[model samples]
Target chain A: MTASMQSSVGNPADEKLGMNLTLRIWRQKDPSVKGKMVTYKVTDISPDMSFLEMLDVLNEQLIMQGDDPVAFDHDCREGICGMCGLMINGQAHGPQQTTTCQLHMRSFKDGDSIDIEPWRASPFPVIKDLAVDRRAFDRIIQAGGYISVPTGTAPEAHATPVPKADADAAFDAATCIGCGACVAACPNASSMLFTAAKVTHLGLLPQGQPERDDRVVNMVAQQDREGFGGCTNIGECSAACPKGISMETISRLNHDLLGALRAGARPKS
Target chain B: MKKAVMAVSGIVMVLYLIAHMIGNLKVYTGRDSFNHYSEWIRTIGAPALPEQTALTIIRVVLLAAVVAHFWAAVSLWRQARRARPERYVTKKAVAQSYASRTMRWGGVIVLLFIVYHILDLTMGVVNPEGHDASPYDRLVASFSNPFITAFYVISLLLLGMHLRHGIWSATQTLGQSNRRRERTVNAFAIVFSTILIAGFLIVPFSVLFGLVD
Candidate 1:
């Protein structure tokens, strides 16, 4: 078994010790309340602990001390569910290309001080400390993010002969977990990278061809209506993406959009 | 759709800049050549299209392009502002360029410069000499003044910066960018804008410093 796959708890024979660190965390009572950075120190933190686990320790401490715990979003601590996201040290997903949940405490030294904050886009209003509403992404997806497959027996696995290149590209585009780190990292708060990832993933497949024209058109319209900034292609979104969704997907999105328009898919006026 | 409008209109303006810069270079060839070239633009299509018809058509198209460009720019700016209604309390710029950051203000400066430029050169009303002079004489007279020459230089520099970011952005908007070609695209933006700016600047600087009289 890999070292990481081994259980993280109760390995006392290992000489690895705990670290003491300072955290500057954003705190707010709720969406209506103003938020600010509140500092708290955590001691005796195991290097084996994931970043969220360390946060869990801090929350435990806060509860024992009769103080409000710093609020953050997380579901699966393994990083696949895309629920947990944080801007650690001014970087989306904390000093790594992976999600916040996968980041290990060992990445930091004992004396390190980390600054944590919530995603700061207008569409994503703060719900509480370190948790902003990401339903804008959901709205974008609902607009045209899926293909229509009839309810029936499953088609033969090889019935559709997709080119290997296109299948690979589609899979690459599908890795996007809808975490909103791209929006958080963008200087303009643009969601082009996320929208494009969704657009390209389905658009590349034969199953997605019937809705191609309408999908790009409707998805982009929803994107604009959500108050996401126009993409100027500074490319910070792709850079901050934990899944490494490429900027080329945005280019593909543009190509598809233009094709749709030229093909008489009138965007909602 | 807004981005596509910005990209297409921006390309039209870039094409106009290229043609204008080449026309400005004709002044270095002497008075007859410069004046003849200016006259030639008006006489284009001649009897087939009537007097100044070609020039009129060009002017109308250019004006339309400029309007569309400005409208798209303002619309995009509004959307960007609304996207982040509340600014980050602590922000760090990661992948943006200086030129990209300064685009809005640079555009304002360029707009102001265009107004002064038309008044000074196209209309001759703000020329240092009287408005009745020949086109060549007006060109010389305008550049002869140190203050006028300095303003021209400063505006052109800002124009170059605007073009540096604008061209790269337009390319991305038009779907011409990819990972493999990104560096090439950036280099082309820098080199192309530099050459265009230098081409335009050569005229006034040459006249001011007596390289052309």
Candidate 2:
């Protein structure tokens, strides 16, 4: 394991440390309530504690006092589920890839104050304190994803053998966890990263070929309908992506979208 | 449809710039040709049409295009600001092309220049001394000022930046997606946008440096 992966609870050096930390956390009863940044003082936090674990301790303290624990979302704390997200200081996921759940306290200095809050965007409505409904991304995907394989019977896995290059590319594109970090990091709040990923993932594969034209057209249309901004190709979204998704995908998506449109215009068989 | 809206509006704007530059080439054709060409523009939409109605329509449509372009830009800017509410001290916007990086403030500056341009030339308002100069005289005198020429030059550079991205984006918007067509469209956008910057730049320099005057 690398140094990055070794700084867990079992690490000896991390067990010996504790520190006082300031947390300016966002508190809201629900999506309806107007939210504000509320600061809390936390002490004796283990340096090895994942950022989410530190939050767990803070919540435990709040619960002991019969106060409502600050509400945030997390699951599969190993970073695959894409549930936990936060703006720490000013960087998304508190300054790293993966998620807030995977962020270690060692990334920060002792006696440092941390600002934690939910992702802020009109499309992602806050569910409670730190969780926002990222359904806008989902709606964009629903416009067209998935091969048009019908309802009942399942095809044998190897029956539709895909090209090795296509399969690898699709798997890479499929790594996107719908985290909405790309939207958060973008300068234009453009969903190009998420939309382009979906467009490219399926667009490149033969299984997805039947509905390729409709997929690009419909998904792109849905992306626009959702009030997401057009991409300017500045590429900040790719940098912030935990999955390291590429802006080159946007170029590919654009190319495919045009191909679909042209194919549609030709005289049908 | 925001992407399509931007793409379509951007395409129209690009076409307008190319046509406008072509029209301006009448200056090189001597006074009669220049004046005749201006008259021809009026004649095309003549009778029952007020003088310069076509030009007026084009200007209004271009105005609408500009408004749409900027409105789309502002909406996106606000969204980006909200999405990442945290400001990083490491604000060095490295790795982005300089043109793409400075788009926000550069766009604002260009917008301001556009407003000043209309008042200075079109409406004959705020002409340095506040005296309304004829469009021809306004063209001459305004470009004559070193300060005005410098401002125009700077704004043109910004316009160039806007076009660098806008051209490629507009083609993508219009559904030109093949690598062959994409490359061609992108090259066309670059060359077309560059010519506009060059064409507009030349008029001012020619006037200021006595090449045209």
* All candidates: TM-score: 0.90, 0.73
Enumerate clash totals for all models, in the order shown.
0, 2
DockQ for candidate 1, C-alpha atoms = 0.52
lDDT of 1 by residue, A10-81 (tens): 465343566889999999899887888899999888888999999999999999999988889999877788
lDDT of 2 at B192: 71
Residue B73 lDDT in candidate 1: 83
lDDT of 2 by residue, A227-269 (tens): 6656777766777777878665777787777777778722121
The superposed Cα distance between candidate 2 and the true structure at residue A39, in angstroms, equals 1.7
Clashing pairs in 2: A90-B86, A255-B177
Worst 10 residues of 1 chain B by lDDT: B86-95
User: Which 10-residue window in model 1 chain A sums to the lowest lDDT?
Assistant: A7-16
Interface RMSD of each candidate, angstroms, one decimal: 1.5, 4.6
Error of 2 at B191 (Å): 9.2
